[model samples]
Target: MRLPILLLTLALPLLSQGQTADDIVKRYLDKIDGSKKWKDVKSMITKGEYDYGGIVFPFTTYAKAPSQYKFVVPFNGKYYAQGYDGNSGWKIDAFKNETTPTLLNGSQARAMANEADVELEIPFINYKAKGHQIKLEGRDTLDGKQFYIITLLKSGGEKETYYFHSTTYSLYLKKSIAKNIELEKALLDT
Candidate 1:
């Protein structure tokens, strides 16, 4: 009798915790800015600093219709530019070695390049819950508030696992897997 009661006590809290994480993901999708505003935008210009492997690089991107885009990265007193402006793709290096009319064939690379228009809309899109595998991993206190862990899996093989503030439903961290690189490489080679 004692064992049965103990199991019930432990299970009740686990069930509630899973529900809390699911609620947080739902609220976050409905309220975030990126998901809503970016989906409809046709063109944009963005300037920011990209930090990779502890090195900071100044970057700028411009996008237009029909797969037109320009990306510039400045590092160590030089600038590198790459783009596809409707007709063809091109690159200009620090030494001014120009490569124009270069074909960009990899699906993953093209998808990544095209994603500039969609990234800002992530917060506002209505993500259909095909299914959910929720777990109450653990809790962390940050800036005097606590957060819950939630993982969401979409039917299309895209996964997002995020940490949401318990009180605000605001996300602190999110991980997603998009596009398959092996298939992309094979496409590029052909």
Candidate 2:
């Protein structure tokens, strides 16, 4: 009897550990402030400036609920457009910027579809149901700030690591190796 009781005590932490990860993600979604409003928002336009290595580039992300998106990025003085229009994904010329529109299918289109989710949901929500996997990789300090390292493995086989504020649970950074995109945009208005 005493041995069984002792075992339960030891197992409690492991049980709660799984829940803590879910709690962290839920709190994060609450902190950001959206849900029903996001559902009602048929379209959203996020305007902001992206700066890298001391250079600032103005950009905008437009999204429609469920999965429609269009974003423009400036490169070498011209703007490049990319988006998924519900039916299919497309990309404009990078050199001429707007001279041509090309169809995007397969992995590239799938990536765009993932990004095109206008709700901007907390990835952990229904993650398992969607066939995705998430792992909370403990906590640590980065650049003098504390953060929780969460790794997200998408159903599509893409993997991303996200750093969230340890206390606030707000996402501070996201890195996707497959996409080769490392974005830190909390300070930017997006």
Candidate 3:
């Protein structure tokens, strides 16, 4: 009876551990627009700023269904556009010159392009789960809320670290390193 009780106590922690990991993943997915929402989207326009050191460069991205995307940077007055018309992948830069067919080597670019597609709604579908490892880095008090640190790996050698709110399960921060560059920023700006 004593041995059984000890084993059960140890198993309880393991069970809870698995549940916690699953909950974290679910919460992360829920925070983003899910697959269903993605599928119905016909177009998307994202306006954001890319920070390089202390300089902030504003960029606007527009995407139409069936693989048409245009990224415009007003500061440079140019558009870097790409599309797959069900046959080939081509790009046109600010020079109004078309680029030869090029394949994307990094997962980040592919993910971003897919997100721009109206047909493919899932944002992280290109990412494969390599493994799940949890670590308690430390408590971060931000805007009067605490967060937990977690990391997830992808099969394509990409890693994303996430900081999630301890109470709300909302993501506070996320960071990832891309392995390749599909588009040159300078070329786009020109």
* Ranking according to lDDT, highest score first: 2, 1, 3
How do all the candidates rank in terms of TM-score, highest first?
2, 1, 3
Which portions of model 1 miss their true places by more than 4 Å? 1-19, 33-73, 79-124, 129-138, 141-145, 176-190
Candidate 2 lDDT tens digits, 14-40? 775554566777777788664544445
Higher-scoring candidate on lDDT, 1 or 3 = 1
Off by over 4 Å in 2: 1-19, 33-37, 44-60, 94-119, 177-190
Please identify which of the two predictions, 1 or 2, would achieve the higher TM-score against the true structure: 2
TM-score top scorer? 2
lDDT tens readout by residue for model 3, 62-106: 767777765554556555555544333445555455445344435
Which pairs clash (backbone N, Cα, C closer than 3 Å) in model 2?
A: none
Candidate 1 per-residue lDDT, tens place, 64-162, comes to 654667767777777777676665555566636544434455663465354332333343245454343555566777677787766656544455556
For each candidate, give its TM-score against the true structure: 0.48, 0.59, 0.46
TM-score attained by model 3: 0.46
* lDDT assessment of candidate 3: 0.53
Candidate 3: stretches off by over 4 Å: 1-19, 28-47, 51-55, 62-68, 76-145, 178-190
* Superposition error at 75 for model 2 (Å): 2.6
Query: What global local distance difference test value does model 2 have?
Result: 0.69
